[model samples]
Target: MTRPRLLINFAITADGKTSTVRKDPAHFTSKADLHRLLEIRKRADAILVGRGTLEADEMSLTIPAEHEPAKQPLRCVVSRGGSFDPGHKIFRSKGGAVHLLATDPRPDYDPAVYEKSGATVHTGALPDFLHRLRTEYVVETLLCEGGGSLVRALADLDAIDEINLTFAGHTLFGGQDAPTITGALGEHLPRSLEFELVRFDPQDNGECFLTYERKR
Candidate 1:
């Protein structure tokens, strides 16, 4: 049951959609918000992103020297096939140990891609995989920068501890097909996970930053 403190961070449009139906990059949030993200990243022992997110944003997961984290936060990705472009920046980036969680085994899975890139691959169910993260990586805190489906999986498992969201004002990617912070719930049941709004800061612009903690 030893698990890292899981934190999910994302930005959405005024309409609550994380991205357009095309799943475009959400670069709409302010620069201040980007700095805020790095601040949070500096505190985490590892930063995780889903395969979809990785495909969308070739995230390097490197902490800036100004933040001065004792060491680089481990760069981690979650995917079933353990697939990544060998030339991806995460592999070429200096600092940060690269760790990949192959959450599912695939008939056509190729582990050599990750292994050749110097990434440690862990495989299994989400909950058990996270527990192993704490034991093996000493990951006391893990930050999730997402692509919705992974966040959905964590929420369904009731494993997330905190959510940090930035709502951008005056922007609307209004499409019923667009993605939100959580994608389609794998289960059909309607479940309400309760969270307390711990912080709410509205900026001069129409945007606001929000923090929520799961109710124990």
Candidate 2:
């Protein structure tokens, strides 16, 4: 049960959609939300994302110099298959060590390929990988910037501690295929996980920032 304090940061449209039906990059929020995101990210020892989200966002996964963070957080990605592109921006970016967790074992994928690129590849269940992050990497705070499916997995494991969200009321991506914070309109989580709203900050730009702490 020992693991890092898991945190999720997501921006949702008025219709509660995280992305377009095509699963586009989440750029609907304002500059303030972007600033808020980096502020939240600064406190994490590591940042995690599903491969789809990572690629969609084209994230460099590094704090900007202007943010003045003490050091960059480790960049981590999870995928069912270990098929990451070597030319991905994350690999070329200068930041903390990269760690990839391929939850599903595949015979054709070679971990050595990524190792040669300086990324540590891990295989196993999400819970085990998270536990390893805490014990081996000493990650006190683990931030998950989502694509939803990954969030659902964490929720199923009851591993989430804090949820940070920005409600962008000005935009709406209403489509049956559009994804929500948990994922595409689908089955419920294993069980209801209760949370207490700890922070509610409404902005003048038709947006609201909210933070919830897991009630446990």
Candidate 3:
């Protein structure tokens, strides 16, 4: 059996902030990074994102026309409360499959609505959900495009195998409150996690595309 691999792709500022001072959180990546990001998504078996990311970005989560939409990866969303917007474009696509995971016992959602729109709903523990993806769906490569909270949760669980981080050379200093990529690493990471740098490409916007493989 092929071991499941969880790969996280995100961008941060030079100061390690994933967002800017505006607190809106969209200025972390450059155009070049965006292109590479799409390319990576095209190669994966499945793509996963947190609910907050889905709501905030309103992402279509589809591969562009240059790639075959039918060949695109399965899109999955993790929401504890099953609070995803049914009208989102990602759900509108009938060509690809969509899966929604919620922890709520009686989720306040209409499963038929999403099913009609071409999405499947599942409920279970997060780890078990991922395992099912690997075993049932044959998802060997899982890509995580996220809001910080989801990324942190996955990191805490040690489920991630690799991280593709792009650092934009801009600073978003001084905010009332903002989230960082690493927030308060406690005893869970005592000796500090180690990674091997894989790629570094400089963009016109002074952003650096960096990739790292986690040391097991």
Best by TM-score: 2
TM-score of each: 0.93, 0.98, 0.87
Clashing pairs for model 1 are none
Off by over 4 Å in 1: 184-190
Best-to-worst order by TM-score is 2, 1, 3
Query: Considering summed lDDT, which 10 consecutive residues are worst modelled in model 3?
Result: 182-191
User: lDDT tens digits, residues 82-158, model 3?
Assistant: 87787787876643489999867354576777778768889887888888899999998999887677777777677
Cα RMSDs, all models = 1.7, 0.8, 2.8
The lowest-lDDT stretch of 10 consecutive residues in candidate 2 is 83-92
Q: What is the C-alpha lDDT of each candidate?
A: 0.84, 0.93, 0.75
Give one clash count per candidate, in the order shown.
0, 0, 0
lDDT for 135 (candidate 2): 100
| Model 2's TM-score against the true structure | 0.98
Q: How do these models rank on lDDT, best leading?
A: 2, 1, 3
